[model samples]
Target: MTERESSRYIDATAADWIARLDRGPLTNEEAQALEAWLAGDPRRRGAMLRADALSLLSESAGALAPQFEPTPFAPPAAPPPPGVSRRRMLAWTGVGGLAAASLGVLAITTQPAAAITTGLGEVRLVTLDDGSTVMLNTQSGMRVRYGDTVRRVELLYGEAYFTVVPDQRRPFVVDLPGKPLRAARGTFRVRKLEGKPVDILVDQGGVWLGEAGTADAVLLRANTRLVLPDAAGTPLPVPETISTDHVSRALAWREGKIAFEGDRLDQAAAEFARYSRTRIEIRDPALAGEPVTGLFAASDPAGFGRAVASVFDAKVEQRDGAVILTR
Candidate 1:
């Protein structure tokens, strides 16, 4: 095969692997095959991350599998083919049954609770028995456990955007590392920061943040953001009210892009690391603190690293599967 054709074949294979992995657990043989493919070529790993096709497969894991395509997995909802509206497409694909089972519209009480996780650069949408929806970011996972009196979800790691269905009879709460955010009705985003506190952004309704039994708690209303306590159990400051614009920037990863405005280089790299295997190393501590601003594709850390290198007149090198930047 020609060089370009060979590259395209590898990319397509990586995309297919991602779709298969997203469907659920992989068999032992499948896992080994995937590892072998990734080990064959370093560039193949990048192709895998950029594919990130799980989010598209999220809606039709089993029954509707034939109807949904994962080839071009772009976010923010692409329009259906020329004559088809999204609702009609869903109806035809048989998504309603799966969605119903997820949202407790069906008798999910007899079912076992399962955790959902997304691999690097992958995004997944999960619906709970309580009718709540969670959009998990790359390298994220959560556990769902519901009971007669309470609906609880544990954010094991990473970030997720939640859309809740209010249940006055049973409060819905998300448990983070240090504390839990309880809500009777609301939509919010929660991110578990590495080596720091969990961040909560409430877009609608109300959220109560604190240790479940503690008297010292805070209320988070619409358009509010706050850092919850650290693992050390440090206290949180008063939540800050934010504008819709700020909220949009924070959640821009949902659209397959990361938006930054006057953010430090180190911070930007950390954000990018969540979506790709490409490691961004700032060899110069001084350069790490330099501020940067822009929007870049979440799956293209090499491009972002090059952009930073150009802006700062630094050097970009690839070593040991990592992108290292130096001045």
Candidate 2:
């Protein structure tokens, strides 16, 4: 192969590895193969990181510019045509160069607002201009709006954990649809999963949960959780005090792990689905109902399946890109 042709081939291989990693954690064989490929060429590691960063930048730009539905997680049915991957990689190079050049200037300016989103199985930590930080979970979206009067953020969808800086003149407010959560200095988490009530967990200090300028706002204290109502007039449930252990388990995703305590087998499967394209199917109703308790890697559905199979005396089958459990 010519020198340029060989370089393009390496870029294509790196892109393929990144796409596979985005789908789910690699199997043992795939992991070993990737290690071998990297060992063969030192440039391959840098190519992989470059491809991944460019891909993330592309996805972020697409998310902010348009209102389009995100593609659901699914295994790749077939490989791309020859040279297609290389062409895509070449295209990213130009875009990535322009983006990198502009990022430094954008960092220093005061932007009115910015939209951010994370793709499937991706976790991101974003630091705001006001010295606060936000950790976004998988498949999450939000808009950060910092103004002269207040630091406001809109949770468009999904979940985020926030650590707010103490600014008495400008309170930090998180807008959840119609409800607004306000705090001056605190650490908290807000989850707005589809088909479920908005969940608010305060880790340190306190926050006011209600509409802005309202007199009946509820105060949520530290180490407490509240399941806010979806409907406008529905009465809010009292905030429940949570233990330190519970907080650690609930926030386990920060470390790319899922912690379960006597959760149903099917429920755990659904939770894992959020982080991987590999579906875990429970064929037997009895097996699906069995209680499970453990901490598992979020990206490794296949490994989780093996663990469940060993514990329940079930069989684990890999077929059509899914992990099926049978008894």
Candidate 3:
């Protein structure tokens, strides 16, 4: 086959893959096959990106078609017939004018940004275009913005754990109210709660905390935790090196459980309130300060309250959608 024919074949294959992805996730076998095909030729990745750009453009045009009136001289263009090639579709849609180098830019820019939210007691997992996954915690909201040079997510409220895929060209950055956290390849968790300082934990790889392309950015490595002050110009504390066990306990919310290692009763109750509508009320100051340690279901506030009361030889009362403990 001629070189042109080989290029056309690659583009067609890429178009088919994009279509499959649009329908839904590919099966494991299909995913493996796609990996193998992409590994076979470096140019195939570029072709895939171009095809993806054309597909996004086509979808956007179709969605906006009803809003615009056709030109007086030009009647509405008819849809392409069955078996019409993606190349022909691009030409018909006037996307052929786009330069090849700009395909990646167009693909990222033309797509609309998405805001993902989770309700109280809800945990959601989101998959991005580049295969990175964001696991949103309870009452969390995040906005996704993919640009030509960077993949950015703004954590508007609540907590989320990000498992970012490595892209040296486009660094993955998660923005909080304060400094942005940037990573090339890493798994990290960021929590922003009301009246509390932002908490960041790096699990698998290192993440830079601060503005991008700046020397002042602090790198938080694996098993490191940083508590960022909410007030601007507050002296930043050193990133603390935490044990693996601490990381696991901190992340127990991911598994629908909350782990407490000698946490005060009031602190544990407040943590439970973040996960459940059923409140745990400890009226006595002494009882509230009692130390509690264990793993308990996040959703079962009553069960947790009962266990605490039993251990402390206190009384348990259910009232007005709350679990109360008293001596």
Number of the top lDDT candidate: 3
Per-residue C-alpha lDDT of model 2 across residues 12-91, encoded as one tens digit per residue: 99888878765665565766677677656545544554565555544321111112221222335786544324323322
Compose the digit string of candidate 3's lDDT tens values, residues 1-327: 644448789989988976876666555576667767765665565566567555654532111121122121222377544443433322222222121211111212222367777777777656566656666778888899998899999998898887665667899989876678899876788998888889999877789999967866788998999999878977678999998778877876765677787789999999989878889999999999988877677777887887787778889898999999999
Decoy 1 TM-score against native: 0.62
How much lDDT does each candidate structure score?
A: 0.66, 0.69, 0.70
Determine the C-alpha RMSD for candidate 1 after optimal superposition of all C-alphas.
16.1
TM-score of each: 0.62, 0.66, 0.67
For residue 268, give model 3's deviation from the true position in Å.
1.1
Report the poorest 10 consecutive residues by lDDT, candidate 3.
61-70
lDDT of 2 at 205: 75
Model 3, position 126, has a per-residue lDDT of 60
Alpha carbon lDDT of residue 187, candidate 2? 74
Q: Put the candidates in lDDT order, highest first.
A: 3, 2, 1
Of candidate 2, the 10-residue stretch with the lowest lDDT total is 95-104
